[model samples]
Target: MTSIEPITLTGKFVTLEPLSQEHHHGLVDAARDGDLWKLWYTSVPTPEGMAAEIDRRLGLQSQGTMVPFATRSNTTGKLIGMTTYMNIDAETPRLEIGSTWNAASAHGTGTNPDSKLLLLRHAFETLGCPAVEFRTHWMNQQSREAIARLGAKQDGVLRNHSRSKDGALRDTVVFSILEHEWPAVRNGLEFRLAKYSA
Candidate 1:
């Protein structure tokens, strides 16, 4: 089965670098921006857990089931979050883009959209993926909205999808953008970024 490889993806607002131990401290600071770990529905790690999270992602990469990236602000050149291509099915040439979180300060900026643009471009044009999936906890309305803003259609809700760190049942909301839908989504992202550019 073919697998996605770790590679740097750059854009005007953000850059997705292959996740590494070197990004540890920067991510800690980023997580501290909004005390992101306090959000119960998400899995943003605390400062001390940053290294372990990086290790976990790297371990998955080693197993050839995931390709992770540390998101960085192109202007500040600081690590702002993490994202990944996971649940890889090389036979179907599909993957899920999740485990993504950005610093609160980076929210509402062009960072997220630009990052998605770069990722989707790579997944479709480079990786030749037929579909890219996104999943978020149902309680995480903000995340669900963000994914929708990217032009992905909600596939459905997975009830009792998994257990959260807090031991609460999580309803997973699934969204996707098929290969045929990429162009329109790409154009929307471009238009969104252009507004920020000006």
Candidate 2:
């Protein structure tokens, strides 16, 4: 089983740097842009909770369960969001790319797909992961559509999967891209990103 290490993943639109408390101010500003913490379906951190969020993710990393990153806009060179490779099963070399949220301003700017490209490429090509999973609240229609657009196939829905931030019963929509599907998924991501380049 290969252990996940912290490394910088740079892409054309955004760069994913190992998450740190140093990013506190920038992330607070980013979250404020969208008031992301107010989203009932997501777990984005509030300005006051930014440090705790960073600490929580870092603590998980120490437990060998997650590798979190601060997403920065390459063009603006500022922190715009955070993401992670969580629910790791290093023995099977599998992981779920969850706990991701970007500044509302970064939406539709190719940051999400670009970030995915880096993470997926590393997981499949470098880590030899058999599968990469994604899970989202069933009611988060926007997120569901975005995941589907990535070319991942739906595995199934986990009913009453957990509780949302607002304490609502949540159904988790699970999706995955297997090793064999990476080629096509990569192509789709590269194609989407190419448009941004041109």
Candidate 3:
């Protein structure tokens, strides 16, 4: 039973609220932090287009294929970033965590790990998904390393996976955590969050 409520998922350091237009202003400010997303070619809507983008995401929600969220810092109760469970495949018990962008201030903090922890727990523990996927542009070394640090193994890159916003072919590097691997991944994420919070 999938529920349509705006479920709130909280971790020790961050909270995830279902995406809403109300998050627009905070997200607009958050986008000014740095060019952390400059190299990303496939990320959608962008800072300038976020308002309409949020509406587009909500449209996808009605199709049951994507669930987006506004990431908030628990300490300050400020919206600091966004993440999503996209490319959802309920029958295959899989989802992809992408379209994630964080403000400059929260990038290296405990926010990311805590956010992922909450989502991972929900997807694997509560929802009983067999696997959860994380994909990023092939050139995004920072993201690839971050995913690896979360204990997700590299699943190879799909060359020419899609066209980028800039009209270039994109290669997507995929990573995943299977149900059997959740224990180690979860523990590693928790440890990382603890270290960051400390």
Candidate 4:
């Protein structure tokens, strides 16, 4: 069963489009906006390594383990970042919305919440998923706050869950919104996005 398919998810501020090699240059420029790769906790690719990273993500998508998206800003008409539906468990029909990074310029622009709202709506309303998970490095306080703002509860921390891009052992902070909780979460996200328009 192909639980996750590449699909375009449009929102007021951003659209999550299926990933492609053609997005490489745009992604690289996004990375350079804040030297995102230099951050120790994130897995963002360097400008020179963008193509290889895109290929790797596509390879995983082919293997049915991930569905990656290119985050595009509707206002700018440019690729601004990337996000993915990863750690897919087809049997449970659940997945994690992760591996996400955005250009520094895109921060505080409602792009993140808009993306989450779109992803969560499709996951729960259309895909019939019971739970949608989010995982971030424990050190990434900004990310943790963002996930929390989306109404996800902390599921707990996984000690030494994985390695960061800098090879540092990472404590993964897991969060989730259950099927029962999605309604409130969706409302909260929508309220947040609505502010961008006002």
Number of the top candidate by lDDT? 2
Which digits, one per residue and each the tens of the lDDT, describe model 4 over residues 1-198? Answer: 556889999989998999999999899989998999998877899899999989999999998889999999999998899999998887789999999999999999999999999999999998889999999989999999999989999999999988876677999999999999999998898888888862
**What are the clashing pairs of model 3?**
none
Give residue 17's error in model 1 in angstroms.
0.4
Off by over 4 Å in 4: none
Clashing pairs in 1: none
Shift in Å, residue 3, candidate 1: 1.8
Which ten contiguous residues of candidate 3 have the minimum total lDDT?
Answer: 35-44
Count steric clashes of candidate 2: 0
Instruction: Write down the RMSD of all candidates, one decimal each.
Output: 1.0, 0.9, 1.8, 1.1
Ranking by lDDT: 2, 1, 4, 3
Pull out the clashing pairs in model 2: none
Off by over 4 Å in 1: none
lDDT preference between candidates 1 and 3, better one: 1
lDDT of 2: 0.95
lDDT (Cα, 0-100) at 29 in candidate 3: 76
Candidate 1 achieves a global lDDT of 0.92
Tens digits of lDDT, candidate 2, 114-148: 99999999999999999999999888899999999
TM-score of each candidate structure, all chains considered together? 0.98, 0.98, 0.93, 0.97
Question: How do the residues 1-198 of candidate 1 rate in per-residue lDDT, one tens digit apiece?
Answer: 477788999898998999999999999999999999999989998899999999999999999888999999988888889999988888788999999999999998899999889999999999999999999999899999999999999999999989999898989999999999999999999989999952
